[model samples]
Target: MELHFMGTGAGMPSKERNVTSICLNMNEERGTMWMFDCGEGTQHQILRTSLKLGRLEKLFITHLHGDHLYGLPGVLTSRSNHGAETHLDLYGPAGLRAFVETALRVSEAFLGYTYTIHEVEEGVVFEDEQVRVLATKLEHRIESFGYRIEEKEKPGRLCHEKLKALGIPPGPQYAQIKRGEDITLTDGSRLKSADFLEAPIPGRQVVILGDTRVLNKTIAFSKNADVLVHEATFGQEREALARKYYHATAAQAAHIASEAKAATLILTHISSRYQHGEEQTLLKEAKEQFENTHLARDFWYFSIPRKTASHS
Candidate 1:
């Protein structure tokens, strides 16, 4: 899976960064893309990339903040124009349905496709054969939420050499053994499927948090995540101001990742105050706390690697 950052700025648009928006590309696995936090100018950012707006199947809003959701109307209209005739699922806070509906109504923007809005609570909001999405309440200025996406474990690899050694011919029976089904051979011997299959590889987990202050509970919430995407609106020097505004500093975000034992930490929602020369300092500060930390820039994409069973 790949995470494509359309916008990474904290509050408003700047010369260097836009607001908050990310597209999780699952086209290779699920033939669709999932979006998180559509901010202002998000569609414009998509235009800069090769992402097709019609492929966006789901939109998970974090909160009701203007900076987090101001781009929804435009994106929806554009998706309709781009021929997204199927239903689009939207999940967010309690007032999300009202906000989206009102904006579309007032603007008289008619969509060719139907849409479903789900006001989420702190638990599993979406699940299918391939993945499950869970949400937890975050400590922010408003009733914000953090999302954890869990990809289901894929089938284990077939041990072709083992099958050959067992004198199993390359036939339809090989398919049954790969599926963990025991079958009787031509010699009246029972073929054990387990011996021909490798151990199941574990699924990956991605935690994406909305704007929030550093909370101790996050450590457990994000435990062992393959990728933890957290907002770093300021540096350690501005901790006091960050807390007052219900935002986290770069050092704090790294600390959370370290405590959670997350494999990687991506710091986004950067403040525009840090100009070209100064932005590197934020990444440096975060790396000091957690070596696996990375600063997110606009239009950057992160590919999440799968964890094999042997590694665990």
Candidate 2:
């Protein structure tokens, strides 16, 4: 899976960054893409990338803030204009459905495809055979949320060489063995499926949070995440301002990642006060608390590699 940052600025757009939009590209795993937020100009940003509107299966809004929203109508309309007929699912706080419906109604926008709006609560918002998405309340100025995306464990690859060595010719028995089912040979000999399969591959977990102050629940919510995407809207020295505004500083975000034992920490939603070169300061501060940290830029992509069998 890969995370594509369409916009990374906080509150408003800047010359160096847009607002706050992120796309979780799961095309390789599920043939679909899930978007996190859709700030203004998000459709414009999507035009600059290789992402397709047709593949956008689900959109999860963090909050009702304009910076985190305000682009739903345009994105939906554009998807329709592009002839995307697949259904779309939207998940967000209570007012999200009303806001989206109002915008579409007022603008007289028509959607070619149908969509569903789900008012989320603090629990599993979505689940399928391959993945499960959990939502938890965050300490933001408004009713914001953080999402934990957990990929379901996959079966290990079949040991072709071992089966060949056992004189098991290629047949329907291969599929049975791959499903971890014991099969009886033609000679009435029992074959163990476990002996012909490698260790199971563990699923990956990704945590993406909305704007918020540092909270103990965040650490627990993001435990052992493969990638933790947290907002670093201020520097360490501005902790007072961060707390007052219900935003997190770079160091605080890093501390949460460290406490959660996250594999990688990605900081986004940067304040425009820190210009092009000054972002390094935030990165430096976050690195002080957690070494494996990355400051995300607009259009940046971070790929999360799958865990190996041994690690599982």
State candidate 1's TM-score: 0.94
Residues 73-154, candidate 2: write the lDDT tens digits: 8899999999999999999999998999999999888999999999999999999989999999999999999999999887
Candidate 1 residue pairs that clash: none
Query: Please, what is the whole-model Cα lDDT of each candidate in the order they appear?
Result: 0.92, 0.95
The TM-scores of all predictions, comma-separated, are: 0.94, 0.97
Candidate 2 lDDT trough over 10 residues, lowest sum: 303-312
Tell me, by lDDT, which candidate is best: 2
Clashing pairs in 2: none
**Segments of candidate 1 deviating more than 4 angstroms:** 164-172, 186-188
